[model samples]
Target: MVLRPHGGEKVRLMVVGRKRLPDAERHERHWGFVEAIADSAKDLEKGLRAQSYGTRTRGERTQPAARPAGEGVYAVTLEDGQMHLSFALELPAKPGEVQKAFRIAPEASYALSIKNPEKGKPVNAGLREEDEADYPRRLQEEFRGRRFAREDVRLLDFEGAEFILIGARSNPEAEYGLDLDTHDEDYQHAEVIRRLRMVKSRHPIKPLFEGRWA
Candidate 1:
């Protein structure tokens, strides 16, 4: 994935797949790897926090940890007074059911916890509004002149962070449900939106950039 900082410089984030380990081992190793990266980054720059995203299946279910996982992972750090992060994920065949998980930026999560220890509700109302407002433009840009449909898009408070879930299906005539074929443009669009939303929601204070950009 390509991430552009506030200054317009782009950085590419890549996920290295763990092919030898079983699901359980990979899950454990992934978080450890993330922590190591965050720690190393912090040595150079203090106050870096770990963040992540990933996909989970029913059989793959595991007890929740202090940090959560998704089909991907990220490390959020401070850069020139702005929060910066990178994305990485394993893109496997579309699971029978896609469960996107997110561990919000640590500092923000902690602040929310202190403010409402009982509820820890994410202050994402404004983010949701911005997403809805930008959906049409994002869809048009992603679809271009092609035909497609928004399969599913939702925002939920999960594990203390706001989870933005999005899916799309292309060639509307080909199937009545989400076209899981990863190579399909529609499926690609959905992935882009998923990642875009995650990054858009990352902020030290409030969420930034309301719209999706490839």
Candidate 2:
């Protein structure tokens, strides 16, 4: 199995299994499946970045690579016999909140997940029957109605959080990670496109995407 953590490397371990595990035992089965990582004491310490004190990008070799100091929301999952541990695509509900962005793995594709309706009942969230669901991937209020003096940054959001989204214009494999099934050609406004790139630039976009697709 592969452990895709925020650390600079992918920790791979092999788990021998009978190939058939009971469904009732699935949730509590993770602790039992861990194989011998054979990672040294120093290696384990560095994996968690126990020595990190301040935030540093992956290329900043001067210090350890780790998350920023704050309340970071993450999506941790173990699926298909591979453990996926990474920062999630998200926005802040309040001001002065920092979104956690970790290093981009050149080996992995960073896709966006733009929409999520009420996972709970509608009545619990005080929603009308016809109300459109929240576009979690959509950029609601970026920079909180503010922008830099010179940087013409655009922002958008998405949830095609994997290999499925090509993010291209009119391509069959391409998809926009938005609440509405949008495409690059369908976007009439340049401002919306600009904001999407801004959001992509934060953590793992740079040379890989350059914010061409949000």
Candidate 3:
């Protein structure tokens, strides 16, 4: 398997098939890869930074978004019984929280080194819909009316979690991973397009994409 780092949004695992597996199984395995990559990235970041005192003292080297088959990012190709996975570290394009941590005006990007597992990866599987559906309004209090930042980050995290949990509960042989079709295809595609447009719209910024058909 080959692992290449795309940029910062996600690690792409490309799975080519003589034949595509069942939808549920295929989705589960795909997410299994994402969880593996995300977990390794998290562990490595923590180990390298050492946040014993907790809070803001340690650097924030969090994993970026987890999306299946997108572009200008790393691609994991799975064909002929072999798998290739790619990894990349991404940051906000402009000066912001990430830049503050790096102590530069958002100009520098670093490579995050992490290890992988021989077998497949484990995913969060997440809390049930009933478990945290109420979180959004609650989280609003934390941000204290900072709508843009909250909308940008929290909405993606929470909605995606709910969707994952619902899928896990419904699918008996399922693993916790991202399956875009679990949500509305047309809407999800539009949303992804929006994100791509946002990234591309940045001044003097070039565009990146993967999994165009996906």
Candidate 4:
């Protein structure tokens, strides 16, 4: 994980992950960036989880949400004074669907950091030239219709929330896994692809993309 100051109030965080395989040549690597507001760390975590996982469950059954497998990294961004986190995953070209195999990881870890961007350097956000030019306009529009900036609002801060991290059982007798095939693969694939493309197309420009202040 790498963090560099984005614009005045945001940070650009890049997360890189690698999958180890018996064959060195077969190893896989994945990476993505999160542009998050430079606010509370708790907000950053919440934003990352939401952007990465989406709504917890879908359909009437309300199943346990799928989880990410392999190593993963994430960051946060602030849009219109509210922090937001975003990232992309490479899935089969199918739309709206993410493979179960893609979600479950045997082992993974993440690191978070914050720093100022390099001087006179530009970051590629994987946007087309035209899309890049229009990014500022889109950002302006996002906040234009809003009645209040998020910073102007105040909410009670609460403490004493309990958090836990649990590891899976190593013994086969104690380990359990679910194997359920209830949804149409084609539909799910299409849906996942559609949503991913939508996010990609938006291509909002981050302060980091434009370079940091001197």
Sort order, TM-score high to low:
4, 3, 1, 2
Residue ranges of candidate 2 with Cα displaced over 4 Å: 1-45, 48-61, 69-97, 100-214
Better of 1 and 3 by lDDT: 3
88-149: candidate 4 lDDT, tens digit per residue: 22222221222222332222222111111111113653323332212234333433454322
What are the Cα lDDT values of the candidates? 0.24, 0.24, 0.25, 0.25
Which of candidates 3 and 4 is the stronger one according to TM-score? 4
Candidate 2 lDDT score relative to the true structure = 0.24
For model 2, the run of ten residues with the poorest summed lDDT? 148-157
Error of 1 at 185 (Å): 20
Query: Which model scores highest in TM-score?
Result: 4
Write one digit per residue (lDDT tens) for candidate 1, span 138-172.
Answer: 43353233322122111001112122211111122
Candidate structures ordered by lDDT, highest first: 3, 4, 2, 1
Error of 1 at 189 (Å): 12
Worst 10 residues of 4 by lDDT: 153-162
Residue lDDT tens for model 3, 1-214: 1122333443222222221211321223212111112322223222222233434766555533322222112222322332222222232223343223322221111111111111112365433334432344554454344322212223222322221100112222121231212222332243333343322322112112211221
Q: lDDT value for candidate 1?
A: 0.24
Better of 1 and 2 by lDDT: 2
